[model samples]
Target chain A: MDLFEYQGKEQLRKFEVPVPEGRVATTADEAAEAARGLGGRVVVKAQVQVGGRGKAGGIKLASSPDEAKDVAGQILGMDIKGHTVKRVLVERAGDIVSEYYVAFLLDRSERNYLGMMSAKGGVDIEEVAETDPDAIARVHIDPLLGISDFHARKLVFGAGIEPRARKGAIAMIPKLYNAFVGLDASLVEVNPLILTGDDRVVALDAKVTLDESAEYRHPTFAELKSAHEVPEQERLAKEKGLNFIKLDGDVGIIGNGAGLVMSTLDVVKAAGGEPANFLDVGGGAGAELLSNALEVITSDKGVKAVLVNIFGGITRCDLVAEGIIDAFDRLNMQVPVVVRLDGTNAEQGRKMLQEAPNERLIPAETMLGAAEKAVELAHGGGA
Target chain B: MSILIGTDTKLVVQGLTGREGSFHGKRNRDYGTDLVAGVTPGKSGEDVDGVPIFDTVAEAVAETGANTSMVFVPPRFGADAILESADAGIEVIIAITENIPAMDMARTVNYIRTRGNGTSLIGPNCPGVISPGKANVGIIPGEICEPGPVGLVSRSGTLTYQIVHELTQRGIGQSTCVGIGGDPIPGSNFIDILEKFEADPDTDMVALVGEIGGDAEERAAEFVKEKMTKPVVAYIAGVTAPPGKRMGHAGAIISGSKGTAEAKMEALGAAGIRVGRNPTEVAEIVQELRG
Candidate 1:
């Protein structure tokens, strides 16, 4: 789960990583109040998951409480990169001497933790990587050994951090690593880790992505999820225990595994249709789960047609067929559903669907054919 | 001559008493795998479908000579299960448990790699290896596969079945199908399995099913270009997946400009591998290469 800037700062503070004092405000009045409490020039940053907040005018500087309210009001309802800003973080403005970047993230390729640091910060690291690759220093830290003093020093030195800030960067790097591992975060990025005028190092911005799998250990993480942060469809899907991602398209997709579902999405696109959503019923899905998935997909009024693709390994196709029939009956589904069943009682499942007497339930032999049929139906063509 | 498992594979299942464990255990055994033992601590001496159960992997290895271990333990104990199997000197460990903490996997994978014990770990969220008609380990449905010269590796479970089904339908069969799991840090990667496939005598060409996320496919493309002599057909999913959103799999997300299907396909195509636009096209490519 991606944490908002304020939440990320709060988490960083717990690890004793110095961050600019900030207060989360949901309303413009509350933001003004927060700025007043801080009693100085403040920056009101729109709390959204996406980047480019500053470029999108979702972030603004306020010299006084009234200006803070006006800026927060402007940002609160702003949509940057499709994410509506619902909250703003009012933080006391810092006197920056130099900007730098530091992060600890899971290096998927290496299957280890990776620490990255750069003297150049407050910008997209990817841009820095492309333009001056050597400016960014990367180190792979062994999970067993963790970030040692030497390892921290290597990043600090390799990034060519100024000698004046070396000790502070070195001391701060390990704390960030602690927050990364201790919080079960997949990524802990501190952009514009500023060297203040007083020579103190502080994280000016935080982008922390926690591993949802490790949420079992961190029960308090539930509080981090604000209800409005999740879309209605996603919230409903989560409640149903189905893995669903909402997308803007016409054809709804439901499949057995993640790969197959993603492949199905690609296939749908190849067949000249956009996928409405990515829904994985997961392994060993039964009739009830399938019905629930169908209900969730159909709930999206944008979905004109649905594609049910299952290559059952642990999941039986017969059960999936039953679920389709069950969902059609339960939801009174009006959308055309092109169903493709393969592996694990596929024949029986096909026979059941064929006999189900629903004109909307169209069974196809191959995944490609099913996608094409779904696409055609979604475009108001006859199947 | 399969790459990972064959008739010689003496399989032991961890968490055998669990629903998924016991179910797949019986199915694998029924597929004619040498299902010798199961490990469920405190459930020692118990048996799942007549396969002996031991309290620990050490005991299971010692008594049954189980060389290959299939793990179906919960996410919390998944790392421990893999570590236990590796410490007990198991040659091949395939973990089918999903949602194992990334930190736990990192530590476990690091230990296994640094230990240099020749113990190959396949997955922590994968469907295991299947040598068609020889042995089935993990949860790949044995019915869809047929013994042939084609080697298969995938980052998915059911998608692997779909491709294998396509192969079987075309009268083209597989020597071994390895599902490396769809986690960010799979124990075995595309290159690892591809290397084995290149070395295997029975395997002629390969079909690789990759999705978005990580540099695994890009790296595999480099490996194929540099080392492998055999033909490789590849298909990558999530071409339409939007950035910043995970497409079902934990590892199947397009992060920044990296790990995009377009980039992966380009890399593989540039490496001289036949990159399929879709799964059926992947099968067609393999069939054409076979002919």
Candidate 2:
């Protein structure tokens, strides 16, 4: 569950981390007004989960209210890294004496929480790791001991913060760590964890990715979920309790099992077309889920074609095929659906699909062939 | 002849008073496993499918002398079940519950590692270990399995069955098949099971099933490259999976530019592990490797 920049900043503020005063604005006038409230020097940052927003002109500096309005106008309708800028975070620009990156993630091999802090934090951590590997400092936290003052101090010092700011960095570490565990975050990142000219440490930017598995414990957080920010198809899928995440491509996919769905995605890419969404119906998913899934994919205006890949085990392939046929009938879907069904009763499923009256329901012999057919149909081929 | 369960393996069911427990427990008993006793806290002297339910795993182990356990406890209480069974000196334990919290798993896995006292755990979300024609444990569909020499290890439960069914269709019977569960932190890893397959003379070749998360497959590939003399055929699922969206299991999320199907496949390929494109290909690859 990726939080918008404004939401992440709000979480940081709760932990007493100094973030620039900001307000989210949906319109240019609102952004201009927010900039005026911030005394005119502000930054307009497009709110999207994807990175490289700065390079894509999603981040703009405004020296005056009018400039803020102009910047917002330019950004509001612009596409940044394939995501449209629907909302912009208008924040009072701060002085950055230095920038650093800090994040926490689970290290499976170590079987503990991993704390990574880098002197070079403003850019992608991947770039930092690839180019200047020595710039990043990695620390493993023992679950038993948890994060301690000493550990925090060592990490801060190791990240190469100046001696003068080391104490403040140490002070901020525990606060960030507390927010991470308290908020059930899979990733709590402060990219460009800034040092202001006033000798104050502030989180200039926040990118938090929460763990949905811990949703049962955080009811308030569940309410804070921003489905409006997600793509239209995925938002609808979520409402129906279907697991869906929209991608950038045109081929829509629905499958059972995480592994199978992913493998299906690869097959699509291998077949010379990009996938538009990854939808998993899960094991033991019945007609209702299947119907919702197909509706979710076919409803996508960007989807040129659809693919259903199932390796039925406990859930029978024949039942899934029945659901697909029923969904096609109920919705009167016009788009092409290429299905690749295997495992128990798969042959029966293929026969059922083949006998279906709809010409759009094409059954493929294998995953690769299914992907190829989906790609072909997506390119406006087939009956 | 199997790594975990076989004819000599005496097994008991945990949370046997529950419906799922009784159901799978009955299946294990009917499959001719040495289903000796059961454990359900404060359910002592109760009978579940004619299996005596004890108050705790210690009592069950003491009475039945069962050295192996198949756990069907709910997610919340799963950690305690594993600890209890481990404390009872069980040789092998398999947990079949899904969605055990990360924090709970971290603590439980750490404890199991430190205090396992030579005990081995198969899963917290997996279909338990099965030795065809000998014993059955966990929730794997038994109809797909037949006693033979090929070994199978997987993360996805249903996919494991699909691969096994395909294998069975091709007259390829399994030696010992284990599901390591899809959770990020599983009890047993690929290396743990691979070592068993490597050492078992009955096992001719191993079929490895992986998914689009973590470096588990890469590690397994490393294991196959450096140590194993027998052939390894690997298939990583979820190539079409969207980045960063975890639908099936919490631990199955793609994070930090790693754990992609492409990455896992490339790693496995570099290690000389024959990568199967689909479930049906797994058996064919293993067959080629066996020769």
Task: Specify the highest-TM-score model's number.
Answer: 1
Q: Against the true structure, candidate 2 has what lDDT?
A: 0.83
Provide the TM-score, chain A, model 1. Answer: 0.97
lDDT of 2 by residue, A1-383 (tens): 78888899898788877788999999999999999999958999998878889989999999999999999999997887667878999999988898888888766766678888887868888878988888888888776567988877778878787876677788888888888777877678999888888888888889887766667777757666843466666678878877787788999999887656766777788788999987888766787888889998888788889999887755678888899999999998888888888766888988999899988888888777888899999998865
* Candidate 1 residue-wise lDDT, A226-281, digit = tens: 52367788989999889999999999999999999999999999999999999999
- The TM-scores, one per candidate, come to 0.98, 0.88
RMSD of each: 1.2, 3.5
Which DockQ values do the candidates obtain, in the order shown?
Answer: 0.88, 0.49
lDDT of 2 at A371: 87
- Candidate 2 error regions (>4 Å): A27-40, A62-74, A247-253, A267-276, A300-309, A333-383, B10-25, B34-46, B71-74, B239-248, B253-257
Which residue pairs in candidate 1 have backbone atoms (N, alpha carbon, C) closer than 3 angstroms, thus clashing? none
Docking level for model 2:
acceptable
